[model samples]
Target: MIERLENVVTFLDKYIAWMFVLVAVILFILLYLTYQCCLKYCARNLSKRDKPRHYRSSTLQYIRFTQVVKTPPRLSTDSHYQTIPLPNY
Candidate 1:
């Protein structure tokens, strides 16, 4: 089992190294950009500065799914044994 784990780790080490390298490169780029923007802010280079230097990017978007909204499920209760809902009037 230890040998198998070592073999798996060795195999995954290459992929993990590359992943870390990619993440490091991306972080370095972002940090450099932020540094440059900070320098510009300190130097007062721009004429108008309404917006922020770094814009936060969204990772996910809110979306509405019709299937989840339009349908209703049935359920049973121990006392009533039938699900009851108010009329949608």
Candidate 2:
């Protein structure tokens, strides 16, 4: 009975280490994917450095997707600023 209990404990310890390694690998993969997404976004917006028209369009698309609206000032003296309204829901 003592030998069997020791074997069970050893097995549990080994599998716990393996579980930790698996979780670490999954976290690394997710981090890498997020990094790739950031790189793609930056490339799209900045690839048209020489062309203002394309750059602006790309920026506008990003802004639209992010739900950022540029609200014009109601008064002549008011400043122009971007606004992201909160969702009612």
Candidate 3:
């Protein structure tokens, strides 16, 4: 009877281990799918074309402004600040 009980216990241990492994695999798959879905959703919604026209125009304006700010003003022969011609957006 003791031997039979030991065999049963060993079987149960293996069965429980396999069950845990299966659960872990399933959970991992679910998590990966969820992450993929979130990435796709974000990419779709955050695409440049999906943005509002005003938002895109404002962003371009900001970029132009930054470029103008980055350029150093040239000094003329008279040591006066030369006016930089700003590009029309």
Candidate 4:
């Protein structure tokens, strides 16, 4: 009975180790495929371009300012003002 138990434990340990290795290999394959896909996508997009135009200026001109006339403020009559009581919190 003890020998059978030891063999079973040994078998289980080997099985568990293989399972871990299989999982690691699968994850590595998936990550590599994802990386390759992203590289291909970036290469395809970067290769085609509508090239943007850049305009260069030789000299800067002085900005013109427009003068605005000030208008006089009208005084408000006392009847237009009102006071409200604040609510207690």
Candidate 5:
């Protein structure tokens, strides 16, 4: 058991630098994606901070009018989650 452990440790020691680089790249991608998502959500939520226009009607709207154009979902997760629209028979 000790010999097997030593061999595993030796293999990792040889590849430690590669593992570190791979982990760093994955973490950077995840952090960048999270930052982008947050920025999108914030931009969508934030409203005007400056002066109002001559008419506020253009700037103001009711919540009921918000519409999102969602793309079609994949086959697997779609079955588990929301039901996807089907073509007419």
Candidate 6:
């Protein structure tokens, strides 16, 4: 058992860097696939008009109104700046 453990340790020591790289590549692929799936799901939902009854909740029903007001901009008269003194710590 000790000999087997030593052999395994030696193998791991030699290929630990490669193992890290392999794990990173696997994680990147997993995240990319998840992102793609999320995008596809979002697109599919956005393209369809008919949604499930559960999705047709009353919370989505609301009235939205926008009012645009035209206002004149105020111009600054004085160019002089005032400086305040700070206390030393």
* Best-matching candidate per TM-score: 3
Off by over 4 Å in 4: 49-89
- Distance from true position, residue 50, model 2, in Å? 7.2
Q: Indicate the residue-level lDDT of 20 in model 5.
A: 93
What's each prediction's TM-score?
0.39, 0.51, 0.56, 0.50, 0.41, 0.41
lDDT of 4 by residue, 8-63 (tens): 99999999999999999999999999999999988877643322222112112111
Model 3 CA RMSD to the hidden true structure, in angstroms: 6.3
Rank candidates, TM-score, best first. 3, 2, 4, 5, 6, 1
- Return the top candidate by lDDT: 3
Candidate 5: tens digits of C-alpha lDDT, residues 1-89: 99999999999887997899999999999999999999987775564332234323553332212211144544676357655454322
- True lDDT of residue 52, candidate 3: 49
Q: Where does candidate 6 stray beyond 4 Å?
A: 1-11, 49-89
Candidate 2 structure lDDT? 0.70
lDDT of each: 0.61, 0.70, 0.81, 0.59, 0.62, 0.61
Where does the lowest 10-residue lDDT sum fall in candidate 1?
55-64
Q: Model 2 Cα displacement at 89 (Å)?
A: 47
The ten-residue window of minimal lDDT in model 4 covers 60-69
Please give the distance, in angstroms, between residue 21's alpha carbon in candidate 4 and its true position after superposition: 0.9
Higher-ranked by TM-score: 1 or 2:
2
- What's the number of clashes in each of the models? 0, 0, 0, 0, 0, 0
lDDT of 6: 0.61
**Model 2 agreement with the true structure over 1-85: per-residue lDDT tens digits:** 9999999999999999999999999999999999999999989877655344533667656455345334432343455653445
lDDT of 2 at 18: 100
lDDT of 2 at 80: 66
lDDT over C-alpha atoms for residue 6 of model 3? 100
Candidates 5 and 6 compared by lDDT, better number: 5
